[model samples]
Target: MQLKSSEETASKAELIWAITGILVVFFAAMLSMNIVITALPVIVSELGGTQIQYAWVLTGLLLANASSTLVWGKLADMYSKKVLFQAANIIFFTSSLAAGLAPNMEFLIGARVVQGIGMGGLISLAMAIMGSIVSPRERGKYAGYIGAVLAASTAAGPLIGGVTVDTLGWRWCFWVGIPLCLAALVVVHTKLKVPRYGTPGKIDVFGVILLVTGCSALLIWLSFAGTPEFFEWISLPSALLIGGALAVIAVFVIVERRIANPIVRLGMLRDRTTILAAISSAAIAPALFSCLLFLAQYFQIGRGFTPTEAGLMLLPVVGGNMLGALITGRLITRYGKWKIYIVTGAIVMSTAMFGLGFVLGADTPIWLIIGALIVVGLGFGAQMQNLMLVVQNTVPVTRVGQASSLIAFCRILGGAAGTAILGSVMAVAVGTSAVAPTNGTNPVYAEATGTLFLIAACITSVAVFTNIAIKEVPLRTTV
Candidate 1:
C-alpha cells in the first residue's frame, strides 16, 4: 500500500510536468505558425518571390500541418505519446533552424513543410494528451490555460517576428523559435511520463501513405489553381490535377474503411455533435487564416504602418482572444455547457468580420479596424477550443486524440485552401505589384481584402447553424 501511494504520487507529479511540457511545446509550435506571418513581406522582398510564392509560404506550412495532423493523432494511439511529443519538438526545432538559414524562396517553402510536419504532431497531441489527463467537464478550465498560451504565443509571435525582422533580420524569427522549441523538448524529456494508451495493433501504413499523398496533391493543386505558376483554371493541367486528387481521396476513403485500424474512423463522425463540430471548425479556418496572414499586410501595405508598428497595432486582436478564452472557458467549466458559447462566438465573429468588411476601405480609421479585431478575437477566443471540447466529449476516451485531430485537420485544411484561394484572388486584384509598399495606399489591395473579409463573414455564418446541431452531452469527469 505504501508503494502504491508513492507510485500514485509520482504519477501525479509526472502528469503535472507532462501538461507543462506539452503546453510549452504547443506555444512554441503555434508561435512558429504566426511568427513568420508579419515577416512574410520582408522575406518576400529579400527573396524576390512572386505573389504566388507569398501564398505558398503560409500554405506550405498549413498544408503539411493539416495533412499530417490525422497521421500524428493516429500514431498517438499506436505509440507512446510522450515519445511522439518529443519527436515533434525535435522536428520543429530542426526545421526552424533550417528555415532561418534558407538561401531562397524554394528553400524557405521546403523548410516550412518540414516545420509544419512537426507542428501537426504538436498541435494534435497536445490536445489529445490533455484529453488523456483531464475530464471533459474540467477541460474547459484547463483549456483556458491552453487558450491563454495560444493567445499569448500567437499574439506575441507576429510582434516578435516583426521586431526581429526590423531589428535583427527576418532569419532571426526562426532562430528565436529554436530556443523555445529546445526548451519544450528539454522539459518533456525530463518530466513527461504519459502512460501508454495504445494497445497492440498494426499502424495503418497504407492509410497514412494515401492520406499524405492525396492531401498534398490536393493542397498543391489548390495553391496554383488560378495563378500564373499554373495554367488557367479551365486548362488541362488544372482538370487533371483536380480529378487525380479527387481520385486519390476516394481511394483513401476506401482504404481507411477497409483497414482494421484506420487513421480516421469515418463512422465516428456520424454523431451529430462530432459532425457539426467538425463543420463549424472547418468553416472558421479560411476566415481565420486569411485574417491572420493578410491583416498584417493590410496594416503595413494598406494602412502605412511599419512592420513593428503593424505588429503593435494588432494588440486589440490579442487582447480580445485572451479575454474571450479566459471568460468563456471559465463559464463553460462552471455551467457544464459549451454549444452556447460556440454559437455565440460564431455569430459574434461573423458580425465583426462583416463590420470590418463594410467599414474598411483605403482610408478607414485605424481605431475602427482595431475595434473590429477585438470583437473577432473575442469570438475566436470563445469558439476555438470549445469545438474540441464538444468533439472530445462525444467520443470515447480512447478516441479523444482521433476526434481532436479531426477538428484540427479540418481547420488547417480550410486554412490551406483559404490562404491559397484568397492569395490568388489578391494577386489578381492587385495586378503584378509587389505585395507590400511603404504607404499602404494600394487601393486594389484594400478593395480585395475587403471582399475577402466579406467572404469570410459569410463562411463564418455557416458555423452558427452548425453549432445548433451540436448536441450537448453530459460532461465526462475523468480521463
Candidate 2:
C-alpha cells in the first residue's frame, strides 16, 4: 500500500509517535472491559454476589457502553475531538478511582458503568480523529496498528486481571487502566488536532430517548429471560413485549428519518459499504464476547485451572490477533477491495467456533483448545479494523464522526446482545440438562457453552455470506 500525500509528507517520527500515543489509550480502554474475566470468581465470592448479579457485572458495563457510543460520537462531531477525548479519559480515570476503592459488587458495577461511558467515547472518537488526520487511501496502515493494540488488550485482559487479582486484588483491573489512560489523554491533547464542526446541529432528542429506551429494554429482557424463567418460547406475554419493542424500534426509525440531527443517519444505511460493515459487526460480536465469558468458565471450572492459569493458557488467541491485524492492514492497502478479507475472516472464525464447540469439555486437550482460539483470534483481528474503515471511506468527510459512531454502535450492541443471548443459552442449557453442576463448576456447563459456540458458528457463517454481498467501489482519485 502506498502512503497518502499527507502521510508521505508527515515526518516519519511524528506519524509513528501519534500512532503510538493513540494505540496506548486504545490498549488501556480495550483492556479494562475484559480484564476482570478471570477475577470474577474472587470478586463475586468476596462481594457475596449471586450468579445473576455476576452476569450483570458484565452486562451493565456493556449496556452502558453500547447505549452511549452514538451520543459520544455526535458530541465529537459537534465539539473538538481533542477536548472530548481528554474529557473522556478523565471520566474513565475518575471512575477507575471509584472502582478501585469499591468495597462491594454494587459499587464496582456502578463505577464500571461510568467507566464504560468513557470507553464508549474513546474508542469511537479516536477513530473519528484518525480518519480526519489520515487520508482514506492511507488509513489502513494506521488502522492495522490500532487493530494490533485491540488484540493485545483483549487477549491480555484476562491475563493481567488474573495477575492483578492474585497479587493486588481485583480493584487494580480498573485502577491499572487509569494511569495508562493519562498518557493517552496527554498525547491526544498535545499532538492531535482537527478542526471542530462547531455545534453543527441540535441533537435529535426524541430519537435519543426512544432508541436508548427501546434498546435497553430489549437487552434487559434478553439478559434475564432464562435465569428468572420469565417466559417460554410460546409464552403470550413475552411475545407481546418483544413484539412491542420491535414496534417501538420501527417507529424510532421513522422518527429518525424525520430528524435533522439524528443519533444515526438513516441514509447512511443505504450505502452498501457502511451497511455491510455494520451487518458484519452485528454478526461477529456475540461470537467473540460469549467465547470470552464461556472460555474463562471452561478453563477455571471445567478444566480445574486457576484464574491466573486460565489467563496464561490463552496467549495463543492474543498472539494470533496481533499478527492478523498487521497482515489485514497491509493487505487492504495493497489489494484495495476489503470484502474478500472480511469473507475469509468470517469463514476462518466460523471454523474456529465449530472446532471450539466440538472439542470443549472438562477433559478437552489444552493444545487443541489453544489452536482453535488462535484461529478465532486471527479471524477477529483480520476483520475488526476494516469495518470502520469501510464505513468511514464510504461516507463524506463531514459524516465521518457519524459513520465511526455507527460502526462502534453496531459492534457494541452486537457484543451486548451476544453476551446476553449466549449467557442465557448457557444458563438454560446447563439448567435443563443433568450435566450442569449445582456449584457452577460443572462439566454440563462446558457442553452447554460449546453448544452456544456452535450457534455462534452458524451466525458467523451468515455474516460470511453478507460479506460477499458488499460491493467495493474504487477509491476516489482525489477526495
Cand. 2 TM to true fold: 0.92
TM agreement with the true structure for every prediction: 0.95, 0.92
Cα lDDT of model 1 by residue, 314-391, tens digit: 768777888888898999999988878988988998899999988877888888888999999899889888888888
Which candidate wins on TM-score?
Answer: 1
TM-score of 1: 0.95
- Which pairs, if any, clash in model 2? 435-444
Total backbone clashes of candidate 1, pairs 3 or more residues apart or in separate chains: 1
Question: Which candidate should be chosen as best, given lDDT against the real structure?
Answer: 1
On the 0 to 100 scale, the lDDT of residue 80 in model 1 is 79
Model 2 agreement with the true structure over 1-479: per-residue lDDT tens digits: 23244444456666666667778887888888879887776677677765555666777777777777888888877888878788888887888788878888788889888988888888888898777667776788778989888878877899998889879888777788877888887776666646554475687778877887788778767766755456664567667668877988998999988877888888888887788889888888866666786677677666667778878876777777788888989887777767777788888988898888877777787788888989988888788888788778787666688889898888888887777777667667656412222234667766676787887787777678777887877544222
Q: Once model 2 is optimally superposed onto the true structure by TM-score, how far is the C-alpha of residue 261 displaced, in angstroms?
A: 1.3
- What's the true lDDT of residue 405 in model 2? 87
